[model samples]
Target: MAQLRYQSRRFWGGLVGVALVLGGSGCQPQQTSTETSPSPTASPQPGQTDPEPPVANPELAVYWVAYKDQEQLVLEPTKLPLDNLENATSEEQLVVAFKRLLEGPANTDKTNAIPEKTQLNSLKLQEDGIRIDLSREFTTGGGTKSMQARLGQVVYTASSLNPKEAIWISIDGEPLEVLSGDGLIVSQPMTRKEFDDNFSL
Candidate 1:
């Protein structure tokens, strides 16, 4: 009986030991740890800067001329600085004004009477007035009405700068003694009042 009891105890103890070992093995972790790094970014190279913006021009005001309702000569004042005329001498300023006049009316509602081919030959500023010489084209082709309007354009544009003074008009350096268009005798040193008497609203 004692021998049989001993064999039964041994068999139960062996079975319990095997079960513990199997349980411990099954509970063991598979991984230890994990780590990763981020990718690098590129930097801007030398002379790879952004572009700059445009510079603006300075400006000033001056006078010009345009025709109104197709009959009367109108004063069209505008900024003449952009043409580098703002700092020019008085003579140069007159030249600039005439240039703008020859360019024609900027506004769609106005029109120009001065001939396009007419060139400013010389400008002589005097104590009491200004003397102007124009190309032969100044007197070519325009009839009475056209010639009158063209003369009005010059008189108004030039006189506006010095309202108290007069302006003498000439063709190719010769005195405009007569207006061939209407046979009107032109006096030296023509004033705005004289032009206004002939044509104005």
Candidate 2:
């Protein structure tokens, strides 16, 4: 197998973060942190346990869908650590951060004309990759090219943090046959180059 390394950063609260999801129903919100390499540092005080960072609060994020000038995947009752807002380290926390950013303006690219809001409907860790399910609002209000750019933004942004080969994008919990006319179907393993090229990372 060829060994390759790919990196990405998603902006939240004016900072870049690891793996930023573009749209969904209940994902977490965040800013990006500017670090090519992530160093495992101790989370201070309350965030610190003897072993590791505290687990995410239960039901901390709720599912919501938003539409209007800007569509959204909303997550109510968002829960995450307060001090270091960028770079969520765990899978559960990453999920929550995605939801929050989707609802907020993390991935909203007005210059590119992609609706800035997204949410996390469902996320599961399957094998070596993370399965992220998205809502219909993700593909709203745009031409084919516009939507494609947006999809690229979402895919590369999230995959940058997770670095998973297989990405299954679903519409309202069902897999999409083709995203923006690209052969971006579910259950296919994406190489780092494929992901970066397709999503413009």
**TM-score for each of the candidates:** 0.59, 0.44
lDDT for each residue of candidate 1 in 1-201, tens digit (9 for 90 to 100): 899999999999899998889778976777756654533443435866545568553233333455668766566667555456546787777777777677776787656656778888887888868988998888877667667767777776676666646888889978998876568677778887876676543
lDDT of 1 at 73: 58
lDDT of 2 by residue, 1-201 (tens): 122222222224324332243333236576597766534663446766556657543322322223334653222222345456445445565566566546544333323333555557787656756567777767677655555455554454445444444555666877666655444443354534564455431
The per-residue C-alpha lDDT of model 2 at residue 177 equals: 62
TM-score between candidate 2 and the true structure: 0.44
Predicted structure with the largest lDDT when compared to the true one:
1
